[model samples]
Target: MRIAMIMNGFPEISEKFLINQVSGLLEAGIDLDIYAAVRPSGSMRHFAAERYGMYDRTRYTRAARSTKTRVLDAPRLILSNFWSNPVAATRALSTKRYATAARNLKTLYFLEAFGKERYDIVHCHFGPNGLTGSFLKDSGIAKALIVTFHGSDINSYPSRHGTNVFRYLYERADLITANTSFTKGKLVANGCPEGKIAILPVGLRMEEYEFPKERVSRDEATLLTVGRLVEKKGHRYLMDALPSLRTRFSALRWRIIGDGPFMNVLRDHAKELGVSEIVSFEGTKNDQDVAAAYMSSTVFVLPSVTATDGDMEGQGLVIQEAQASRLPVVSTLHNGIPDGLLDGRSGILVPEKDSPALADAIGRLLSDKDLRETYGNAGRDFVAETYDIPLLTKRTVDLYESCITS
Candidate 1:
């Protein structure tokens, strides 16, 4: 079978899971070609293409904005990039926002890039970006189209547009996949047919994430959170909880891994709260380092929430990754987290945006050694059974076979 996987970027450190999926498909004896609108340049591009057998669709033209160009025309570029539509570029010019234009441009790019490719299945990784694949499928360019919803795309983009594009994609897609049941339910509530949606949590390379036997434990009880340092991640709320937590557990230390737009704001908040000494903003560690951080920490927390702009956690993969390292998780009932945690079984789930609850969960895990151990063991078992790459890859391959054969 020939499969075409599409996403916004290729070989991104944050999106290694997509690369893993493509690798899995290839290992399963399926011919796979990765398609992306933008790709990194120089040796990185060549290495990624060679490493993953990706076909360089982005090389069709150098029309995309460079850092210098983007800096100069930030506003105009944002507007044009957002509004241009590839499928109906001229038509989208009448629309108000730049997002529409950007979508058009992407669609146009895909239409050109995919014109000569013979793919049995065209699978996209997110919803808004899935628009291109969905359009191609609708236009009879691909034999079948499937989209895997990865949190924010479903929680934010579709809700903002109010267009039936998501529903249309859901209805037309050969299959729809969600990382957790919570996300699947969200999709159903948003009018996607329940029969079409599959609960397929993002898989992890267990071998690569194996808990180290000789991991050195830190002196202070450490709590960790790893992901993009964005508002929706609820890092601010975690920082707010620190002051109260410190009063009770003075030996507590907090480590936030990853960097983003909100880092400075979080840094300021930490200083204002006087917890600067205890909080460590370890900016964007690599995967092995992240696994080591998970091993060293007493507990992992993801106090995610629905941002003001409607952005939310679809399914927190970091929670699973932490659990895979045999660390107990402290998270919220936001989006698909509950589905991932199994509540009282694997980890504790508190109400979203509640620092008190967040603090309490972390404290509980810290105070009770047995409960923490039990939850940690249970979490590792849960990840092994559910999100292991080999098992997940097989299920994904089954879905692809069904889609192509049908």
Candidate 2:
């Protein structure tokens, strides 16, 4: 079967879900094509395409002449299209409310680009872009349309709109997949048909992230967190927990991997907390470097929270990657993290923004060797059983078949 995976951007360093899914489908002998509205910029452009075998299948279109131009013109277009072609702009206005006006201006850009591609199933990630795919399907461009709700799209965008674009997408999609039951529940609550949503956890390659044989035991216990250094990641809470935590475990070292808008703010907070010496911002690391960081650390902690602007952690993919490397994890019971971490079984889950609880969980893991090993082993087993790439790909293919045949 020919499958087209639609995304806002292809080969994005941040959204590895799209990359991993495409790679899995290709490895599974499925004829796959990746369609991105915009390609990567600068040095990242080349790596993004090559990393996912998207060099050939990927298609890029000129959305806007410049970022400034796109920003200024998007809303004007949305208001213009709101009256004439409401169906075309419904998904854009509803799914990406902030960018609805701007995206509405670029509706023709997407319509033309998607019109040129032919596929059996158009499987799109997130809601805004999925809305575009839905529009195409409705326009009779594809046989069937499938959309995957990846966290923020459902939790923040749709929930805030109260059955605007999201409800429309849910009602029109042939199938809807979510990364966690938490997200699926949100969709069901938003008036989406319960029978239509499926929970499909994102998968990672076990071979690529094998447990290191000679794991390092640090004299100063090291704690690691990997992700974009954004507000949703709850880096500030982690830093806040550190002052009290350092009083107990004096030699604790915190290593933050990944970079984002909040990096400077987090660094400043660490300095103000007087624990800057213990904190090391390693910035963003490649997959190999990330895996190595996981192998070297005592525990992986992601104090994720729902951001003020409604940004949230869909499912923490890093927890799975850390677990795959046989490392114990500590994260908050926020969004879809519990589904990925399995609470006490695979990793410890604490309430969001609770530094005391976060500190307590980290301290417990740091002190107990047997508990850490047990959790680490359980996590690895969990990933193998539920998140193996082959298993996930098969399930996705089955979903695609069901969508097309129905």
lDDT scores of the candidates, listed in order: 0.75, 0.78
Provide TM-scores for the models: 0.86, 0.89
User: Model 2 lDDT vs. the true structure?
Assistant: 0.78
lDDT of 2 by residue, 1-406 (tens): 8887777766777776667778888888898877777775424443434765676788765576476877675666556555555665565444343234224444455654664466788888887766677666765557888889988987778556555656566767888898999999888887789898899988888887775476545334789999988899998998988888888887799999888999899888888989999999987666667777887888899999999988899888999998988889999989888888768877999999999999999999888888988998899999989898889999998898888789
lDDT of 2 at 375: 94
| Clash numbers, per candidate | 19, 4
In candidate 2 the C-alpha lDDT for residue 254 amounts to 93
